[model samples]
Target chain A: MIKHLAAASLLLTTACLAIGPAAAADPGFTDTEILIGDVEPLTGPPALLGVAASIGHKIAIAEANAAGGINGRKIKYVLEDDGYVTARTIQGVKKVIDVDKVFAMLGISGSGQSIAVMPVLEKSGIPTVIDVAPVKFLWEPARKNVFVVGQSYEEGIVHLVNFLADKNPGRKWGLITQDDDYGITVRDGFDTVVKAKKLNVVYSGNYKKGQQDFSSDMLQLKDAGAEVFLAGGIIGENIAMMKELEKLGIKPVTGIFWPGRIEPVLKLMGPAGDGIYAVDYVEPFAGAAGKAFLEKAKPLVSEAEFKGINRYTMTGYAAAKVLIAAIERCGKQPTWACTISELEKTKNVETGVMAPISFGPGVRFSNQKLQIMQADTATLSFKPVD
Target chain B: MQYLVQLLISGLAIGAIYGLIAMGFAVIYKSTGLVNFAQGEMTMITAYIAWTISTTVSGNVFVVAAGAILAAVLLGLIIERLVMRPMLGEPVFATVMVTIGLAVILRSAINFIWDAYPHGLDIGIGRGIVHLGSIGVRTGQIAVIVTLLLLLTAIWAFFRYSKVGVAMRAVAADDRTALLMGISATRVHALAWAASSVIAGIGGVFFALSYDLSPAMFQLGLKAFPATILGGLDAVLGSGLGGLLIGITENLAGGYLGSGMKEVAGFAMIIVVLMVRPFGIFGERDIERV
Candidate 1:
């Protein structure tokens, strides 16, 4: 009787070990639902980006769930507003990880916010798709569970400088940038390309973030005799700089990054925004895919939310598509490891919003190609520069 | 020489707007002995209100500005009665802290309503450049300078000659004594706020005409703080002149040294002036009895 009992115990132990390796437990996953978390600036100045991104994520997730969720488990998405602040982002991430126990994260906004939550994400080994703020620091060293969508400002500027140099060679260039990480990244790109191409660089000036007066900077550039200027600023700064340039009567062939390509900027700049060039990775809302995205998104979100869509919305949608695709590829019994493995192996996935995306081992940043666009004063819209 | 003149003109134009905003701060501080930190947010909110009026009501610049100013005056009166009047007789620091809180609340409210995007004023200014001999001046710049001088003259005349203005001055001197002398301190405070709000509203309109309308434009209020300090927190006309001085200094520094020196130049001038005259160029010197 003792021998029989020992044999039975050994058999039970072997069965438990076999089941442990095959069926892994996920914290936020249940038989009917899979939970996902998002940390974004839903309240601050950058809230436009966050609001649009949230709508994009929601549309994509709703579409997926409507079509039958991955592996028979519907996704439950949760978002926390970080106000574009670093400290708040840390708390948001902690709450999502510890309290909400989300299986993964999507739509992480702002470069500083992303950097702040990097440690928490790494320690937890949760899959995160950063849709907004494609800063190089987030993916250059390539963390295990992190994947980045969209083009970095550095890469976008590099492409822009190359395009500008190819089009107008030997033009004396100057830079008027904001004094922040975003401006520094743009400057780095400009410096690298200018040195490599031996282009003439006349001046470089940086102003504090949120600075409205650009007269001094414009005059300095005008004094330096710069023929072409790169405006390394965001929406408001770009418009202010252009207005100041017009006020100073210094009409240099200005070049701007992706942020300056929005409708609000064109409207604010009015006729002055004419002839300015921008480097963009995603197509405008007027594109075929973008129209389709809007139409599909219209039914899913409110009219006001749909109207708020911008270029960032495409990236947000594409990110959700990638996340959904990875989960679908996980087959049955999806866990964090399976989702990450599928994501690492993802290749040439088309989302009808932007260019094709691919990721592999130790590789991140899915899209790298950028298009040159010129602002049309007649239409107040940006068209691809041939 | 052309570059220098251009810088000077642009500097003075920007300084004029700063002076207008500074006067707003000075008026409130003089009347209530409380620093209204929400002065900048008030300017920004009023600018947005003007923009909304332009879009929703009439495209005429004058009408939009008048409507915005009216709205601003009402807002100022309401805020004074609802938010500040309750804190009367409180500690000065506590009242000052309340103003800071009000600033945050006002900024958040604007963000909630406007959604943090740049809007064009399109008030028919800053569109063309007028060449004054070798120096070029933007029409917007000219408008700003002229309007500021006229507004300053009007404010100076009112305070120097008007009966209500005398009552306000009396209240500023001694609220209890003013009350004993048949001057209503509450009425004086309300009038001061309303006047300040109107001045801020005008500044906001010109600022939006010069640059794009944005919530961050409120930072201009903080930048104007040095001007108020340089002029004298209690001296309205002096603050206006101080703003021009700071603006010119900043522009010259930025032009000769670099763009980074603009802010430094303004603050450095303030420090030098304060070290020499602690009460400011036009501030009253107090004699305390031991």
Candidate 2:
């Protein structure tokens, strides 16, 4: 009878344990460690873009761990590649959330990829910081668990215009961009500056994405006498436009957004893209902050990667730094709620490479200020000027 | 009027590239009775091969062109032997699926070998601009236009006069009858692939010149598809011309209509044309949809 009673009590104990509450630590949280992961395009056509951004994440995470991590809990980071496709992005995000059970996510990805994974991010309620593309809708609606640490295209354009206008002898600002969302964003930004500053506007032309020839657009812009040009074309389109403009023997004072600051774009632009200006929320590779960043980044990555660092790298680094800082504010016992509260309370935190980041209650876009840098064909790099 | 002239020149130059890809596409469809879905990937990979050859072997146009053409031909033959020959008696859908699989393999291979970075073809062959009156046209554009003209003549001559071309045409018309008449269907099919690949090679190089050479350029092949269907699937010359028409139309639409109409105009024309002619403007009525 005593043996049977012991078996029943043992079964009862097992049942109680099975139905009990989960462990005290949230999903990826532990007393001694916090697990973080990200999704980026590690393969496919956008690999160059994604890989550069991912390196930034690695460098920042490395620096954090080397600095003894957030309040003594070592940070463990995991990365999943999305190959730049929307469906793959969803799959990658889900895999990291379900499989990795990450505490939070800090990665740089394409605008479309970020937008596609929002639903997954929403369902999982994982704290995510979007880097690189900061298209407006992601932050404006203020998804509870998400924050954007990058500047929007609108802000980038605003910076470009405000910076270039003072140097330009002519006030006739013009824009030639894609007809898609990118162009619309550029147009919106241009319109805002034009209205606010009461600047002279000459011509605006929009072309379909993947439109090959730019001769017509250049001719129109030339006819309109647009001396200060804002080119909103993505990589291939930008190079093609520059070539066409060169063919026509006209080089306007041009300004492109963040993408123009990459090494490859600068290389492809060669002579034609010389003297063109670009804007970024992060420090350019030639800027003072950029120099300071190099000192921190040099020890974290290979010499080869250090040389290839561009604007995308800075964005990723900045995002990870901000996320890490917020997690650090959560102190010894970090929960998602506490981490998110700490994130909302984050303000005036200098990320070294970017403008000082700040966030507030109900506010998710952490930074808006940007700096202008001009492409130097001679050095094949971007140099910031006062 | 000068603006119109400029738009026309630009349109024709770009249209010539579309025509180049479309011609290759139409030729494979005509000869094999199987649409080569991997044609765009072929164009992209060969362009990369051309880029490699130009950079490594010689930057001279003649050497690069020769090297690219040779690579394309070999690639075509190998694909035919490995992927096409094994699926001889399969269902047409199965063949299409296989071709798609082949495309994925080729695309992945390109991604693996060349990476996703943009490479410039600064061979100096297509750099200069010519001024005809108030209009300025780039040398690359002229090369594409001239190549298309030459390709049209070559295709016309090959189909009408060349003996091997006649055998290929016999096989395309009726493979069973051609086999009974001492022409080998397999040889013709292989020849068709090789010939089409040569066109893809030439097109790829010029495309890299006309635009930027990148993995994203594989999409150019798909863009040219509307040109193929707008012409006849089997009408090689028609498909080439169709590309030019679409290019010119897109430019005119964008120039006059508020730029948004450019994409719609070309696709709308295709829908209208297909509604009128189900077999494509140049596709044969008697042939199976395959």
Best by lDDT: 1
Q: lDDT per prediction?
A: 0.85, 0.82
**Cα TM-score per model:** 0.94, 0.89
True lDDT of residue B30, candidate 1:
87
Evaluated on CA atoms against the true complex, candidate 2 attains a DockQ of 0.46
> Once model 2 is optimally superposed onto the true structure by TM-score, how far is the C-alpha of residue A187 displaced, in angstroms?
1.4
User: Where is the poorest 10-residue window by lDDT in model 2 chain A?
Assistant: A17-26
- The most accurate candidate by DockQ is 1
- DockQ of each candidate's interface versus the true one? 0.62, 0.46
TM-score of chain B of each: 0.97, 0.96
Q: What are the per-residue Cα lDDT tens digits for candidate 1 across B50-86?
A: 8888888887877987899899999899989999999
Clashing residue pairs, candidate 1? none
Total residue pair clashes for candidate 1:
0
True contacts kept of each: 0.68, 0.54
Worst 10 residues of 2 chain B by lDDT: B254-263
